[model samples]
Target chain A: MFDFNIVTQWLDTLLMSFLPAWATVLIECVLVALAIITLYAVFAIVMIYMERKVCAWFQCRLGPDRVGPWGLLQVFCDVLKMMTKEIVNFRKTDQLLHRAAPFLVVTASMVTFSCLPWNKGAQIIDFNVGVFFFLAISSIGVVGILLAGWSANNKYSLIGAMRSGAQIISYELSIGMIMLAMICLTGTMSFSEICQQQENLGWNIIRGHVPAVLCFILYLIAGNAECNRGPFDMPEAESELTAGYHTEYSGMDFGYYYLAEYMNLFICAGIAATIFLGGWAAPLIPDWEMWNEIMLYVPGFVWFLMKVFFVLMLLLWERWTFPRLRIDQLLNLEWKYMLPMTMALLVVMAICVSFGFIWN
Target chain B: MENKSYFSGLFSGIKSLCTGLKVTGRELFTKKVTERYPENRKNNTVSERFRGVLAMPHNENNEHKCVGCGICEMNCPNGTIKVESEMVEVDGKKKKQLVRYIYDHGSCIYCMLCTRSCPHGAITFQPEFESAVFSREALVKQLNKPGSKCAEKPAPARPAVAPKPATTADVTTPVAPAAPESDDKVAKLVAAAKKAADNAAAAKVAAEEAAAKAAAAPEDADLKAAADEAAAKAAKLAIVADNVAKKVAEAQA
Candidate 1:
């Protein structure tokens, strides 16, 4: 009932009736790009507000409640304030790279977010190597950080950028390994195909069982570490690095960086939801026919959002609960602990996939 | 031994992480302790002894205990208190009468020395704290309300018995023999406040009439100018009225 493809198809026909095919295609591209940007910005705003509220709740305090009702408009006011602030730059800074850094970061996040399968046939880009594309695109954010830090000619920014570069590079291995473990079980790199397989197979987590759950946990850790969130947030360690790689940035430039960070969190949560927790697949009982029928009545997009927010909550929970890990401990955890665990889990996943020991 | 310790350490570390999660998770649903200031201002309580600002206790009759002793002014370390007193003839006797009790809240350190050292106990700290203002001049307050009399007669101008206990029954005596020029100034301020308010009301009515005229003659430049002029006059008069009303309140307070 909530299939978005039908609406898109109707619009497609209406546009085709009036416009040339090339123009129609160009306009559709622009529309999708605009939609993706809007989604990215909206998710950033929601996630930031959610993070604050969740953090406040965790600490046994009322968060922002003075701006609007329950302080819902606080973020909008914050955005306005940030947008109007004077953009300051150091005279010695590399003007071009410094200017381009925030945009690059935002673009990287925006590109990765567009590939997410929100519902049945609602993906903007159905890339053949969808999982790999997300992995590759997400890493470009660190490059932006490095550019911002190096361009600023500030010691703290440079150190922060270097640390982030190191942290993301190391964690990327664990993320890739964990995804590989899932890939072994699901037998597809395309996100939609993986999700579709989860429909009948009763979610890769239940199908692959032990190894899948291990991969899920490990993937969350890797995702949190990669996002530079707390516990693994050695790069933007405010106690030491002030504001880290974007220390020199101000006004909307700094705002873009902030937006990109939260967007990255959402992207990570979305990926985890799609891969491990059954993207838009509703949870069903094995023997209850009536229950299965009831589950099918709810829309897939809502299920997708539920799973994504659940994962997002877990990420934020981990962030606020744990203290920041030292840089040494961060790399040590990745190389020593997370890496070995994923490798062993990958082998176990391969055995499960080969033996047909998964649920159907 | 090393492998056993390593594996045990891993399990323990995982357990501790879970314990931390459980702690924070439990806290998530617990009662929040935020004060929600501004929203809960009525229920919010400051300590009774909280030295917010100094204020003179004027009785229901608008009479204060300060007999222009100036001891509170001398005890103020920051010179925050400036007690202006003048000689006045009451019952054909010259007595020191308080004209103004200027208290600079911005400079006051809240030391309470002025409140404590007052022999007559004329002033004390009030708990009314939300005293923020835009300008520094607003922080400097005239504590004694305008035209308020001393609670008692000046004790027959006895210099030796300056710390005599105030008698409320003595309020039947003649109040401050206010100088003629000071009385004229107060009258002038009250007149100005009334005049400004009337001018604002007149300008508003004129603007409304001009707006109606402009509506009738859409293409008339002169009519529009008249309307704009009337609106401007109303706006200026409204501001003047606001200032004068504030001055009137200050005078009365």
Candidate 2:
């Protein structure tokens, strides 16, 4: 009989026999780094095209249809253009920090994917404190924004950086508290374990009571603010700040920052799907015997992508529909509204856990 | 109340998100509207009154009636026209021939003043205004018709003046008969003066009536002001009444 446990044990034994511990670790790190980079690049390109198309649709025009059958290569042409352009560093700027900011920001976002559980047994590093590690590492992107804003030597960038500092720091609390509620219900910080727990009980969204759902919604909003996405993208408000933190970044330097943003978006959505929607869990199909037989042929990375893509589409839809939140409005939504709401939800979730309202 | 359950807000948030999704879903299927610029430009036609380059028309006789009079040159406010006249010998008589009538279409305001001021029935406005060109020199147009010779001339001018009348004795012989004629003329002049005086009196009466009507303008203005104030007050009262009715309906519900 092909039990899931034996399958894992056999694979572990085979891996141990063939490779040294350090060599195996090295291979995994290399593979994960390659996958993350490749995925980020692909998504960033696709997202740019999608955004243009969405904008065009809303404004009542056909977008990018001529490039290569619906303007798929439009982003490529744009990227090529941007790559060839000159990077102009202004006379008044902290050259060192200005140069280093985007690279660091993008690197920070890329590093978060190292701990995410792609599928059942597919992950770069199955760290025990995976969720915490992701939270800790991804928040470092704010440093990039701060560096970009301060080093540009423009007042708009400085003000934008300051606003970003306030925004990320505030929204992070609500996001953290919301994630903490999930941690309470799941009783683990490991993303894979959390997903596994959900598989045992339909989905955390359905199983973990009303407060957990509230936490999920709050986390989504806070995550949006953290990434400086619409309704919360005050950092790069073109109308108010002429591109906010990256006002001075041009050519490939600007491109790097842009790529990092979309990369962060994918990473955030991946985390959200893993935490709430039961990552790669086949839902309500009822043909488990057939699914189990075919599941092996389908790679874990593909499942991860399927789930991530769905979440990305949802996020894009949100971006198109919602009007952006003002800076003061954004902060109030965080400190006054989201923080308190998430805190109360956490308390309620705690009560539900103690009373066995979950998994009943 | 028992800490009104806060899940209501969460439910509302989910509801709003669903509503947004529905809207986007509908939009995804709608036909797109885009004007392909190059394609449209190939078939595009401009309106008749598009105000393009100005042109002056020449007659069927292959002759421009420009008399070298320089009226068009003087009337062109922008100095877009230059008319040069030359003294040419026609049949051994001197005449002013129009050597050149140059028009710079670039500076023309399309005011049609030059066309209107041609006193010799020379030029008329033409509607063929599409005169965009690459070079500035291409915009300059020569008004003179090709191979057209200058018209022949007449002789020079002559002034006419007469001698003054004689005085005293010449006046005495004619003055005796002229005296009676002068009396009759004086009476006719007196009659004409009386009729003029009557017309002046009638005109004065009409002027007084006009002045009286002008004096009543302020009263009409005051009446209109009062009417406007009443209408504004009525609109405000209607708005207040509507608000009250809405509140009453809510209370009843």
Candidate 3:
């Protein structure tokens, strides 16, 4: 026998024992950040190509087949082209905020990944208030957008940024309320604790009855809006405002903002997977302990990636199929429709929890 | 009408979401229609009849049929044709021959007129239309082959008819001959007079027809009705003059 398990367990024990707590935390943070950034970059590149191909397929045209194999490297080539292009900065822009905005947005997006519980033992920071921390940190990116818009001295950019700020803030309420309902059911704010709670109580999605499903759906919509994704992407309305808030950005700054948008998408997908899909918990089967033991051999990070990619695909599918909403329509959806409906769902969920309908 | 309750409305939203998801789910598995072009171009070839570029055809003798006849040049609505004739020695006699027949493919409308108008039967449609080129000069085709002149064909000769022999009975009949000669002279004079009269009548008729055509040209409504009836009997070809010009330019290119 090779005795692989013994060696692995020994190595794990040695590392856990020998490493200083602070150093471990620092190393883990750097590793996770690097992983998220890498994943985000790859996902953005792939998604851009996928979107173009999907559009071409729908429209009955062959898309970008000349660049690389099946045009997979077309986006990379386009990125290179963009990199070589001159960065045109208008003379009237506020030199400081206009330049700093993209970095701020990207930084905020990167930080949100810190709280995402990829799997049972795989997370950058498994803090007690992980959900709240993610929400708080993610919201700050909107300020950067607003600042960029205001500093650009462009009327369209300013309007777009203002709209985005209002929209994200408005949608955050419904999203926060829905998450609160999940928190109430789970009885913990820590992401890993939430995942463990679901495993113990058989997925909050199914355990908390019908209303929980409604809350989950509500969370998805709110999250989509928060990311300024389709149906709610009025702020970056390409048709009307060119590129909206980032209309003035060029070169690497523009790329950073673009990267940040996708990173936000990645974070949103991670949150959805963690909160509702039971993290990396395998479906219960007979000989559950044995199955859990087998599952442990498969790294938790891989399962987390699978779940996130699935959610991301779903988001992209929604983006491509649906027509974008008008600014007025977006506001109406939030204040008039989503807000009241989510409130009702929350009330129903709370009632269901009180009546012992949630956990048996 | 009874108003729907808030709970029912909420249920409707859920139903719509499910419907949306179902639609997306169906599309996710549907065969992707991405045709990787360049790889698939050989299989998905365009039809031969597809109008791409215009090419001019040379005759069997490699001589152009243009004959310096500016019919195509005149007929082209878009000034795409440029024909230049030069005086050259043909069979030891100076003759005006078509030197340059330059057709701009870029400006050609592909109307096919030039091929139709080539009286010498030199120009024809070649059907090799893929004329994409980098320079403007490449688009202008000089149709005249180097060191070649228009080949002239000789006219065919007419055959002679045999005369009938005069009989002795015809010679003996003096009275008949005198009467017949006078009659023949009178008849000849009469015939000449009749011929002159007929010529005058024909001239009048032709003049009347020309006047009628000129007058009727403006009043197209009545003229079209009459023309249609006449055309039905004569089987006149409905040739669009502009389209013919375009085709000629395309062929020349």
Full-model lDDT for every candidate: 0.87, 0.73, 0.71
For residue A246, model 3's alpha carbon misses the true position, in angstroms, by 1.0
Give the CAPRI class of candidate 1: medium
* lDDT by residue for model 3 (A54-96), tens: 5554444556778778788899998897788777789999988
Error of 1 at A287 (Å): 3.6
Give per-candidate clash totals: 1, 0, 17
> What is the C-alpha lDDT profile of model 1 across A237-298, one tens digit per residue?
99899978988999999999899889889989999999998898788767889998889788
Tell how far residue A132 is off in model 1, in angstroms: 1.2
- Model 2 vs. true fold: TM: 0.62
User: In candidate 1, what fraction of native interface contacts survive?
Assistant: 0.88
Worst 10 residues of 3 chain B by lDDT: B157-166
Q: Model 3: residues >4 Å from true position, as ranges?
A: A1-65, A78-91, A286-297, B1-37, B47-49, B55-76, B81-103, B109-130, B141-253
Model 1 C-alpha lDDT per residue in residues B131-242, reported as the tens digit of each score? 8999999999999999997887554654422222122112211121221345666566766766666667667777889999998999999999999999999889878877
Give the best candidate by DockQ. Answer: 1
lDDT of 2 by residue, A223-335 (tens): 77888888788988899999899999999999988888877777788888888777765443335767655754665556667877777776777777778888997886788
Candidate 1 residue runs with Cα over 4 Å from true position: B1-4, B46-253
